[model samples]
Target: MKNYIVILLTLITALVSAQSTRKYSNEFMNIGVDAAALGMSNAVVSHTADVNSGYWNPAGLVHLEDNQLSLMHSSYFANIANYNYIGYGMSLDDRSAVGISLIRFGVDDILDTTQLIDDEGNINYDRISTFSTADYGLTFSYARKLPLDGLNFGVNAKIIRRIIGDFASSWGFGLDAGIQFENNSGWKFGIMARDITTTYNAWSIDEEKFEQISGAVDGQNQELPETTEITIPKLEIGMSKKWIFNYDYSLLAAANLNVRFEENNDIFSTSFASINPALGFEFGYTDLVFLRGGVGNFQNERQIDDSENLTFQPNFGVGFKYKGIQIDYAFTDIGDQSAALYSNVFSLKIDFSIFR
Candidate 1:
């Protein structure tokens, strides 16, 4: 078991170091928030008009009618990882809003077996320790209604923190911008630019702790990992419309085009950028009970036989609202159609006016 633990730790370290050189830095932030949004496969950019908008599309925050708070929690990788989020938003006035949000994704109590076998080559359970790896995101968002009717804009100032126990850590900074527009016909359109200024993370590794595992595997950990990581900008465009029937039933349809500036397996791939399309729907009864579903993450997955197959993720969710408070639940998968395990997500939202 000790040998297995050492191998696991080494693999984790290698993966961390490899990420520093990849285009998807700070990926934990991409794991959407709000169960409602996740259930819709993150196709809510055009209609996320609440506190959670601070993450999906800040411009939606301008629609806030009162001070609001939101919370969400989800477990991933068969409960080996925990993702938590909290957010607060309030109208600064009829035309402006401000919000603050924090997100954390972590794996805790990982066995550190680097020191389990000392110089004498003797196994010592007492020397075994544990540590955790986590990533945190703090965002300050501001939104304002533009002079034009049904136009709003927003910006996000983000700070990122990442830790791998006492072995490595990093701090990053970035900016995001978004805009939304609604037409008299009830058509909503939105655009969100993430890491608009190109986020950068600077890492600091403790040589002492690193050395303990440096020799765990030959030809590995011989060099100090890259000290800097960069994340380029990504864009998402969305559209949505809502229809009411019988004065007691309603339906909302939303779609999103997610773009990354690189070639990938997305349905629409190119050297300049790749686009993944998502579609979602929500059915509501008397504006109190809701059911939602979506499909997204289109990709060409490779099979063991070296053939490529199209795959996507499907999500479903339900919500209830009353007296300015809401509860939501979602069944989602972290991996696309290729994986078997699914995660449960839950979220709560409250309007301060509920207390008044």
Candidate 2:
């Protein structure tokens, strides 16, 4: 037990320092997947037990009762960006499971005006072209039950791909590990460590295309951008419990503490770290219909008058399940209690059983 405690502290403290640091690198992957989770302000880490768990806490994949497939889609920034996800999970045996997931976040049809002014000094409308910028993540996960009852651990291998039209592209790799434990009293706890190895993205730029716009702006784009980007490690811990009333109505409440190495506007902050708390609740009736709500993304914002104010985002959602198929919808604010508009997120899940 002492050894375990020491290891835990080491993991937490070791993350306090970062090398080759680039904050918010590979950020698109953090936008999250699954409407059910987004509806809960992304507080489902402890109790995620479906195909989507491949993106949340892969340990939960061990709880899959059968083969499953999941898909989700959402639009952000008033439809300027689109995000999509697909996942599959299957139990290898009573004690192990495997999962695979793919995610894409992209902005399409962006007009490129670099060549608008032709070599002859004429403004040619036809020179304007459209292109897309996108990021993709593919993950493979595996989970196994530990010798200790109710304990499970999982690991993920992630491949990241990013593209900017034909001008630039990058490939990155990372690893994630997670553990989940449930007690006899119906309480659950979990921890997830993301990018534990400090993921790196190495870019390959198109010199010809870059040179065309190198002088478009004075003193900008004159030098090639950094060829390498790094993403530091982050941690999240969660706890949850569920209650059933009259064996018909049920409620599950969960909370998560998200920790980052650098100090920021999170609810709790220090020079070396910051902690953000998220709360989520789901109410179910007859195991067929569900209602969910949550509030998270707490931040300390500086007012126009130089004062600080606390703010957060609120989310709500509904879900229906029947005959192994489930559909969920969520209304959420992508911005952290800012002026940005809300977005609609939808997800679908299907379970397959050999007997069925």
Candidate 3:
């Protein structure tokens, strides 16, 4: 118990003292917060107690005492946009599991655009074109524990689509692989790799720049606009570790390090990015209810200015169970440069289990 306090304090101090980091190269608006929050605490790998096991470390499914079902959702405080997610899972037998999850992101409403013209003296108006943008994805997963006691793994695949009215309707696909380590004391370790392969091939508009129009002897002569495809790169590697105490209590902490193979400046570019780490904790009473609180972005600040510091973003939540359903809610920092300051996330999960 005393060690727990020291650990928390050490983490808090590190988070406060570390530099802030940022990364680019991915989107789908990052609604994958189940394991994400746990990962923040570095507790997901070893804390296997729910169907969310499928989302964290598929190998955690072996912790299932019975078959289970689950659902999760989150709202990102980014860009005045709305982000949400839902997931479900069940044990196939004593050694296997399967599930599916969906994520949707609503970019803030965009004002419709139209072209208009008026004669020198007469008033005239006309609509040339109109458009908006939205993005979404669906993921399917399958995982099972091998005969090995300390080793377990799983895989997930995603299909994605993006629609920007009258501009581009893009399509992409990606995959995720995860593993968990479970020991008697409930010490946990997890690793997940996301976005190994993805590319967008259905775009035709560049909102940033336009080609010059030239006047020819024949004004009737005109050139069509040039179109290009934007590519989405692979994001790799995250690990988390957690400890479950004398049954009702637990401690979790984690850090995320992003891999960059290129440099970028666009809002979502892979360049101009950086790595980060965070710490968090959880408490429960009698195995029926739990409360969790912590802060993130331990290593995410500018390096040169010791004078300017960013607050450690905090997260808090409570969870309960009714029959086979697991309900969870959390409050976190949205940190969107374009949106309001605070944001909230709620997740629900159902688990189905079968034991000998």
Clashing pairs in 2: none
lDDT per residue (tens digit) for residues 1-356 in model 3: 23422443343334323323232323553434463353244334444445665555455655566655555554544546666666666667877777666677766556432233322333334433444566777777777776667667777777777776654566666665666655666455555545434333344553431121122223243454333333333232344455577876655544444333344322223443333334556665655687776554433234486553344555667777666565777766534322225566666665553222
Q: Per-residue CA lDDT of candidate 2, range 1-356, in tens?
A: 23433565476567546464555689998988888898898998899988988889999999999999999999988899999999999999999999999999999999999989887889999989999999999999999998889888888999999999999999999988888889999999888888887788999999888987787877366778888998888888899999999999999999999988888988899987799999999999999999999999889988999999998989999999988989999998645475557889999999996348
lDDT-superior candidate, 2 or 3? 2
Compute the lDDT of residue 9 as modeled in candidate 2.
47
Residue by residue across 1-356, what tens digits does model 1's lDDT show? 23422443343334334432555689999999999998898999989999999999999999999999999999988899999999999999999999999999999999999988888889999999999999999999999998889888898999999999999999999988888888999999888878876778999999978877897876266777788888877888899999999999999999999987778999999876789999999999998999999999989877899998998899999999999999999997544474646889999999999988
Off by over 4 Å in 1: 1-22, 218-221, 334-336
lDDT, residue 329, candidate 1:
98
Local distance difference test values of all predictions, in order: 0.89, 0.88, 0.52
Q: Candidate 3's error at 8, in angstroms?
A: 31
For candidate 2, the TM-score is 0.95
Candidate 1 is scored at a TM of 0.92
Model 3 ranges with Cα > 4 A deviation: 1-25, 35-49, 53-55, 61-69, 72-80, 115-132, 198-274, 299-311, 334-340, 352-356
C-alpha TM-scores of all predictions: 0.92, 0.95, 0.67
